[model samples]
Target: MKYHVQVFVSLKPSILDPQGRTVERALSHLGHENVSGVRVGKLVEMVMEGERAAVEAQARALAETVLSNPVMESFRVEVRELAGA
Candidate 1:
């Protein structure tokens, strides 16, 4: 089986996000003051071939140990089977 996996990596809420704050300031300068607390994150997308359970497990493991910084960042994993597979 094949699975589509997405890992979203972002700073933990307790941490400060300089890039997100920068973007928020930029947006306000562009006349969009309504935006607040804009947080930035990275999305890692990949397709892996494996059994469903293994794929999900691997994806989550990767997200936890590799894709994110355990001290200051958190991650979320999403998995889906490809359509028409």
Candidate 2:
């Protein structure tokens, strides 16, 4: 079966996010003072064939060990069975 995996990677709380901070500053400078929090992340979607559990594990490992930096970022994976095939 085919599974669809969605991976979300975000900077760790302790890590500095220059892009997010810049955007936040811009927002405040634009008078949106109520906006106090900003975070930046990346989303990756892929289709693969395997058992749900195994695929999810593989995907998470790939994200943690290869696609993302564990010290500076965290990752989450979501898996769902594909339909119509």
Candidate 3:
């Protein structure tokens, strides 16, 4: 099976995000005053071949230890089977 995996990483709520604050200010200056509490995060996407369960497990483990800093950051993993592949 071929799976599409996505890992979303972001700073924990208690952590202050300077980059997010900067982006929020930039957006406000650009006339997007409705935006608030902007937070920057990372998405890591990958395509892998394996059993669906195994693939999801691997992706979750990768997100847990490799893609995110478990201390100050949190991550979520999404896995879907590829279509027409």
Q: TM-score for all predictions?
A: 0.95, 0.89, 0.95
Candidate 1 deviant stretches above 4 angstroms: none
Q: Once model 1 is optimally superposed onto the true structure by TM-score, how far is the C-alpha of residue 77 displaced, in angstroms?
A: 0.5
Candidate with best lDDT: 3
lDDT of each structure?
Answer: 0.92, 0.89, 0.93
- Please write out the lDDT profile of model 1 over residues 1-85, one tens digit for every residue: 7788999999999999999999999999999978999999999999988999999999999998988888999999999998766
Q: Give the alpha carbon lDDT tens digit for every residue of 1-85 in model 2.
A: 8988899999999888999999999999999999976988999899989887889889989898987889889999888899975
Deviation (Å) of 72 in candidate 1: 0.8
Question: Measured by TM-score, how close is model 3 to the native structure?
Answer: 0.95
Give me the displacement of residue 38 in model 1, in angstroms.
Answer: 0.7
Residue-wise C-alpha lDDT for candidate 3, range 1-85, written one tens digit per residue: 7988999999999999999999999999999999999999999999989998889889988999899999999999999889976
Weakest 10 consecutive residues of candidate 3 by summed lDDT: 76-85
Q: Rank the candidates by lDDT, best first.
A: 3, 1, 2
Q: After superposition, how far is residue 43 of candidate 2 from its true place, in Å?
A: 0.9
lDDT of 2 at 40: 88
